[model samples]
Target: MTEHLTIVDHPLVQHKLTHMREKTTSTAGFRRLLREISNLLAYEVTRELPVTTREIETPMNTMQAPVLDGKKLVLVSILRAGNGLLDGVLELIPSARVGFVGLYRDEETLQPVQYYFKVPQELEDRLVIAVDPMLATGNSSVAAIDLLKKAGATNIRFMCLLAAPEGVARMKEAHPDVPIVTASLDERLNEDGYIVPGLGDAGDRMFGTK
Candidate 1:
């Protein structure tokens, strides 16, 4: 993903996103849509992955089959909300390694505070994709990427269900090398730092916490 930001506007993605944004969608329904949409987004994110051919014998004949080059992917979920996207992506790349970064926002300051951190080994040798549901303030996403870099992740990508312009700009300024893939880039953040037109609190909606 060379582009700094890629918005997946596939008809299926947009259709499901509309259902997800509806306030009346049930927790079960919301969760289902997220998984489906994540599968599609994962396709877009991995579209440019390098591939090399290997000799393989098919039932009909021998042929060179294309396969991903390099180590299995490493997916690091920015805990809580990130878990929502994790399951769906894993379904697409089951062999990929998994990790977690737990950070909660300080309500008053709107800053991310690290509570837990763990990741797969050889991060620098493999591509690391960080999953988060909503990129509202960007503070949390930026901080999460910071930790990933410190842990030796040179190549990284950010994936989200929705993103705010503020969040995209923030990530670009902080980590321009890392690409962003999102379902929608909604309007500016509201007064409370939530995406104005975003599905309200992805984690809450998916988990039925609120």
Candidate 2:
């Protein structure tokens, strides 16, 4: 966990995160907050993106300006809930290629089973960011990353709105190289494997469903 987890605790992030956690938050409010928070998280997660210098002329002068270097980025959203975070991150990095992975729990084994997978071409050459709203059991998160790696994604990162200790540990053990960015890491998961004190099912909250 030490090597892989990167908790983003900036003041703006924390402030908005608190709002999203409130029980009284409306669907519209929750969605808006998630978008804002995701943008804040993206800023921190992409801090080290490679930059190259290019000649540019301003109104008064010509000078070398910094631009994103090399390949365009890819954003792989773990379907359903992950789409919430994806909306905000996309707002910030509109040029990034989009991908989707859908995993649902098998009732018998309670393990994640992938139902859909799609990613950008040349994933090996681009920086990839996998977004999800919650890291509860970690099964889906780990499985999603495994799929991404198999598709040739090398430089990868995970972003979530909230996470539990168990999930973080599991992810670190499975993929030590990929760093995780999240707004809050809660105390633990409950008996049913949901993050304690979490704001309920993110997909439900975002979609105004029970």
Candidate 3:
């Protein structure tokens, strides 16, 4: 399976992303922009969700209304940073089942180590979307997806605010079938495993951490 990656270069997405990259952006402002971008990204991500018809009574007459098909969708957040995107997505997809995978990177090795994992049942039948803000090294993203697949999720998509080429290539090599969606694909990962020209650590900027 070929790995399909989507670049969401919508003008607004790019504009807000620019502000997000600036060092002077306040936490509140950064968060506000992320929420807006995530909502818009959610639109592109769910564009192809299967739909079914349900008969409903309108003000004047009865008509068949298009509704989402099958089981409610699942949104899996990859730990602390993922929560930022998760909150915005939940605002739009309120009915989506939420899950979390806690994976912290070993700074020296740039490898992912799992600490916690929890997800909704019947994942096999749901459209599982894993969310994380920055895909730097891809180890955490790949590890998170591996857990999802083990738990019976067959259809999975990954969404991120920004991605480095290293992370994208890593994900492609590991999971060729899972598609990726992101606002920007940055140049490369620095030796310290951070995206070049990235907005620092997403978890740090978002939560005011060091």
Q: Write the per-residue lDDT of candidate 1 for residues 1-210, one digit (tens) a residue.
A: 689999999999999999999999999999999999999999988888788999999999999999999999899999998998999999999999999999998988999999999999989999899999999999999999999999999999999999999999999999999999999999899888999889999989989997
Q: How much is the lDDT of residue 72 in candidate 2?
A: 91
Better of 1 and 3 by lDDT: 1
- In candidate 2, list every pair of residues with a backbone clash: none
Ranking by TM-score: 1, 3, 2
Displacement of residue 31 (Cα, Å) in model 1 is 0.6
* TM-score list, all predictions: 0.98, 0.96, 0.97
Model 1's TM-score against the true structure: 0.98
Best by TM-score: 1
> Which number leads on lDDT?
1
- Clash count per candidate: 0, 0, 0
- For model 1, the run of ten residues with the poorest summed lDDT: 42-51
Colliding pairs, model 1: none
lDDT of 2 by residue, 1-210 (tens): 234778898999989888888999999999999999999999978988999999999999999999999889999999888899999999999999999999986746657999999898999999999999999889999999999999999999999999999999899889989899899999898877778898888988999998
